[model samples]
Target chain A: MSDARTALYDDHLAFGARMVPFGGFEMPVSYAGILREHDAVRHRAGLFDLSHMAQYHLEGPGVGHWADALTVNDVATMKPGQARYNIFTNDAGGCHDDVLFYRLDENRWLLVVNAGNAAKMWPYLVARADGRRDVKITSGHGSRALVAVQGPLATEIVAQLVDADITVMKYYTCVETHVCGVPAIVARTGYTGEDGFEIFVDSDAASELWRNLFERGSRFGLEPAGLGARDVLRLEAGMPLYGHELDESISPVAGGQRWAVKTRKAAFRGRDAIVAELEADTHDRIAGIVLDGRVPARDGYAVYVGDERVGTVRSGSMAPSVENKNIATVLVTKAASVLGGSLDVEIRGTRHRATVVALPFYKRPTP
Target chain B: MAQPAGLLYSKEHEWLKVEGDTATVGITDYAQNSLGDIVFVELPRIGAALKQHANIGVVESVKAVSDLFTPAGGEVVEVNAALEADPALVNRDAFGDGWLYKIKIDASSMPDALLGPDDYEKLVATS
Candidate 1:
C-alpha cells in the first residue's frame, strides 16, 4: 500500500522538513533539526501537524454508556467539553490502542486514536457496536486535520488566532470555536509536557489555519516542529508510544497507565485480565533507566543484571534537554524496577551501566 | 555540499587529508548535513588498528545513529577531544575542526579506491 500524506504535506515541504514514513504515513521527521525543534518546544512554542491521528465520532442515545463499556476510562463521568485519556483493551487485557475520549455532549463523543491503530480500532469498535442500535460510529480519518501549538507561550499565541477566550481554558478541556474564521475544535491538550492547545479543523482549511498560526505565532517564537522533536518530548515527559511502550501484547497496567483503568467499575473488555495481572506479583513493569554514556540503549536491546536478562528497552535516546544523560524506558521484571537499582544495557553487543531513575526525566515548572 | 580540494574522499562519505604518513579524517559536508544535528560521537582509541571501510566509530544525531567508516587502513594516532563536549562541530565544520581522528597510514596497505574531490562530487550527486 502507498504511504498516506497529511493535508499539510505541501506546507511541510515548503518548510524544508525531512520526510520519513511513520504509521504508514509520509510525515515530516524534522524541519530545522530535531535538537532546535525540541528546544523550541521546551523554551518557547512549537507548532505540529497532527492531522494523521484518527478521529471517530460517535453520537446517539446511550453513546456515553457504550463508550464507557468499550474504554478503560470512566466516560460517563466526563463533562461536556472535557477530554480523558483512555485505552481500549482486548479480551486478553492487552491494549488495543491508547485513545482520547472527548465528551462533546451527553450523547455525542469523539475518539482520537493513534494513526497506526486507526484501521484496527475502527473494525474493533464496529464489531463491539454490532448489537447496539443507539450509537453511531463515523470515521473522520482523512476528513479532519489537527494542528498543535505547544510550549510555555502556546496559549498566548493560539489565543490570537481563535475567537474564543482560551486563556482560562483548563487542561484536558476543549471548545468548539472559529480559528482564523475557520470552524475548529480548540482543545487545551497536548503530548508535550508544556502547556498547549490542539486545534482540529476541516482538512481543506488546514493549510490556511497553519499559515495563519505561523504568521500570528512568529512573534512568539513558534517554529514548526516535527515528529522527531515530538518523540523526545513525549519520552522525556514519560508518555508511552503505542508500538513502543504499549503494544498488542502489553497491558496498559504493565505500561504504567493503571490510572486510566477503572478496575472498580463494571466489566469491560480486558478488564478481567488486567485485574488478574494486577493481582499477580510477577508482572513486568515499565521503568526509567539512565545510561552511563552517550550511546543510547535503543529499542529491543536487552537489559541485564549480572548474567540474567531482566528486560528489554522500549524507547531510548540521548535526551536533548538533559545534559549528559542517556535516557531509556525499559520493561523489566518487577524485582528489577526498584528505584536506584543498578543494571546493564547491552548496546550493540557492549554492556553499559544504567541506573533506575524516575520515569519523567523532565517536567515543566507549574506557573 | 562543499567538498574541499586536495582531500581524498571515500564512497562511505569520509574525507581524508594525507600529510606524510599521518592522515586527518572527518565526514564530508553531505554526510553531516544528512545526519543532522550530531549530538554525540564515539571515536576509536589511539593506537587501535583499523581496516579500510571498517566501522571505526559511531555518530549520533537527534534523529538517528550512523556508523563512521574508516576511509583507509591505519593505526589511530590521535582523536579530536572537543567532540566530547560539543559534537555539533561535525555539523558546523565537518571538514576541519570536526575531524574525527588522525591515523598513521600503513604505506603498503593504503586502499586504491579513494576518490578525488571531483569524483566524490559526482558520486554524491548521483546518490
Candidate 2:
C-alpha cells in the first residue's frame, strides 16, 4: 500500500525534518534531533503535525445516546465542548483503539482515532450503526489537518494566534475559534505531560497556520517536534501508545486504563468481559521498570523474575528529561508488578536489574 | 563525511587506526551522524577477544539501538571508560575522543577487505 502524506509534508522538508514511514504515512520522525525537540517541548513549546490521525463526525438526532453506547467512557454525561479520552473495545474486552470524544453538541460529536486503526474503526462503526436511523458518520481523515502546540508556554504562544480567551478554557475542553483568520477548533489537550493546545483546521490552510505559529512562536522557543520526540514525551508522561500499551490482545484493565472504561451506565461493548476480568484478577498488568544499566530495554524484550519469563516490554526509552535513567513499561504478571519489587530485563542476552516504580516517570508540576 | 587519511574503514562504518599491531577503533563521522544523539554505549571487555566484522558492543540512541562491529580480529586492550558516563561524545567527536577501544591485532588474522579513505568515501556516498 502507498503511504499517505500530511498537508505539512513540504513544511517538514523545508524545516529539515528527517522523514520515516509510520502508520502507513510518511511522517517526520525528528527535525532538530529528538533530544533537542523533546527538551524544547518540556521547557518551552513545540509544534507537531498530527494530521495523520483519523477524525470522524457523528451527527444526528440522539447521536449523544448512540455515542454513549459505542465507547467505554460515559459520553452522555459530558457537556458540550468537553472532551474525554476513551477506548473502543471489542466484545472480547480487547481494545481496538483508544480514542478521544469531543462532544460538539447534543446532536453532534467528533471521534479522533489512531491513524492505523482508522480504516478498521470506520467499518466497525458503520456495522454498529447498521440498524440505527438517527445517526450519520463521515470521515474527515485527509480533509482536515491538526497542529498541536505543546509545552509550558503553549497557551501563551497559542493565545497570540487566536482571538479567543483561552485562559478560561479548562483542560480537555475545546472551543470553536478563528486562528490566523481561518476557522478552527482549538482544544486544551495534549499527549505530552505539559499543558498545550491542539488546533484543527482545513488541509488547505494548514501550511499557512503552521508557518504563522512558527513565525510568531519563535520568540517563545517553539520548535517543530516530530514523532520521535512525540514518542519520548508521551512515554515520559506515561501515556499509552496504541500498538505498544494497547492492542487486540491486551484488555483495558491489563493496560492500566480502567479509569476510562465505565461498566455501570446501561451497557456498552466489552462491558461484560471487562467486568469479568476485573472480578477474576487473572490478567497481566502494566508496570514501570527502571533499569540499573545504561543500555535501554527495547520493546519486545523479555522480562523475567528469576529464571521464569514473566512478560514483555511494551515501550522503553532513555528518557531525555530524566538524567541517566533507562525506563520501560512492561506487561508483567500481577505478582511481579508490585512497587519496589525487583525484576530483570534481558537486553541482547544480558540480564539487567530493574525496579518496578510508579506508572508515570515524569509529571508536570501544577501552579 | 570526514574519513581521515591512513585509517582503515569497514563497510559497517567503523574506522581502524593501526600502529604496530595495536589498532584503535571508532565509528566514523557518517555513522554517528546517521545515529543521532547516542545516549549509551556498551563497550567490549578489556581482555575479550573479537573477530573481524563481529558484533563486539552495543550503541544506543534515543530512537533506536544498534550493534557495534569490530573491523578487525584482535584481543581487546583498552576500552574508553569515559563514554560510560557521557555517550554523546560519540556524537560530538566521533573520530577523536570518541574512539571506542584499542585492540591488540593478531598478525596473521588481519582482514583483507578493509577500505581506504577514498574508497570508504565512495562507498558512503553511494549508500
| Per-residue lDDT of model 1, residues A1-367, tens digit only | 9889999999999999999988778899999988889889998999999989998988878777777777788987889999889988888988889989888777888889999998898898888777778988898898999999999989888887889999989999988889999888889999988899999999999999999889888798889999999999999999999998998889998898988889987888888888899898589989999998767788889999989999999998878666747899999999899999999999778999999998788899989
Candidate lDDT values, in order: 0.89, 0.90
Question: What is the lDDT, from 0 to 100, of the residue A252 in candidate 1?
Answer: 90
How good is the docking of model 2, by CAPRI class?
high
List of chain B TM-scores, one per candidate: 0.96, 0.96
Give candidate 2 regions above 4 Å deviation: none
Task: Report, in order, each candidate's fnat.
Answer: 0.73, 0.87
Instruction: Compose the digit string of candidate 1's lDDT tens values, residues B70-126.
Output: 988889999999999889999999998898999999887786789999999999999
Q: After superposition, how far is residue A117 of candidate 2 from its true place, in Å?
A: 1.1
Query: TM-score for every candidate vs. truth?
Result: 0.97, 0.97
Mark the 10 consecutive residues where model 1 chain A has the least summed lDDT: A317-326
DockQ of each: 0.74, 0.86
Candidate 2: Cα lDDT at B46: 92
